[model samples]
Target: MGRILLIGGIGAGKTSIKQMLMNEQVSYQKTQMLDFSHVFIDCPGEYLEIPRFYHVLIDASHQVSEIWALQDATKERSFYPPKFSKVFRKPVIGIITKVDLPKANIKRASSFLNYAGIEEPFYTTSVMNKDGVAPLRMRLRELNELYND
Candidate 1:
């Protein structure tokens, strides 16, 4: 099983993506523990809580294969908070969520990526519209295949 870490600021649609993947309703009270699948761990926690929680998982059997940065494109460059980059050495992919939102600018999206020091291509996704999930899934599956190889 591949462990996918969903990291982002509050209200960046992490839960929406998780719900889309699971095909179930998103609820904090119900899924506080963790959601398991062939592809994800679905640990949907705020920025502060993630560090401590991730360290505990350090001694666990699974290692995080990918880190998905669920970013809000409409937000300013300063809005992208600093993350603990030392946590993982694997691939970290930036995902610009809420693509269906009106007034979404691609320039801001690129700026956000530059500010985050990410050079890889990011997905402009809207879980509400289902525009970008398929390509992302294919990319993720490719990553999983590479990891196994």
Candidate 2:
């Protein structure tokens, strides 16, 4: 039950993914300072709180197992420097959301990944249709296996 941190710009569907995972019958606990194992910390996506929260990933607890960066496919790439990338330099994954919307920019998302220098695999998903979510889950499981092996 290692920590899995979900990152992205605001409205990138982090909460939606958290809610999806929470609906599963798994043990989870949340507190003011921190959220426990099998839990998701709902970090503020605003500009100021970004660095403050990401430092938690660098803890020596060996807790943060993965970093999932959610992206809004309908929008262009964020020009902000990838600060979170520096903190959670562990297994990273990209999640491109809003597949239901028109003009989804998967290529731009991939470009963003390339610009961020993230070699880890990524997936496109829509929580509404459940499209691409299963593959993401499978990829996470595969990553877990590889990490453990």
Candidate 3:
């Protein structure tokens, strides 16, 4: 399968999602640098929060087939600027994480993603409940098949 890169602000559940997808034990741990595996490229949130580190992400994007832009559903503000996804040439998928939280506002999160230049069909997920993870796995499988040939 082609590598999928995950990027977002800190505590957006990027690491947790990667762990779950890899069938590893999910735990809270801060990502200090770029992490690579056979199927995913897990980026540290600092890369997105700090402007100077943007080049790091753009450079890394070339190694992956697609990008997953994550947004914490409960966050009051977004780290991404307008049309942020346009910087990468690969396909960008929008994901709203921690949707199971009572404070999560899906509509607001969707708006943030839209402002970041992500289109329709956002995926909502909660690692605690494993909600909305299956479809992502299926999508990844489809991507693998589509690009493997």
* Winner by lDDT: 3
lDDT of each: 0.63, 0.62, 0.94
For each candidate in turn, give its C-alpha RMSD to the true structure in angstroms.
3.8, 4.6, 1.1
Q: Write the per-residue lDDT of candidate 2 for residues 25-46, one digit (tens) a residue.
A: 3223332344454545554354
Candidate 1 off by > 4 Å: 25-38, 48-62, 77-87, 147-149
Better of 1 and 3 by TM-score: 3
lDDT at 63 for candidate 1?
A: 57
- Model 2 lowest lDDT segment of ten: 25-34
Kindly list the per-residue Cα lDDT of model 1 for residues 1-149, writing each as its tens digit: 36676666556677778777667765444235455566666544544245556554332224567767667766554344344433457566788887787867766876666566665578888877787988877877687787773
My TM-score estimates for the predictions, one after another, are: 0.71, 0.71, 0.97
Comparing 1 with 2 on lDDT, the higher-scoring candidate is: 1
Task: Rank all candidate structures by their lDDT, best first, as comma-separated numbers.
Answer: 3, 1, 2
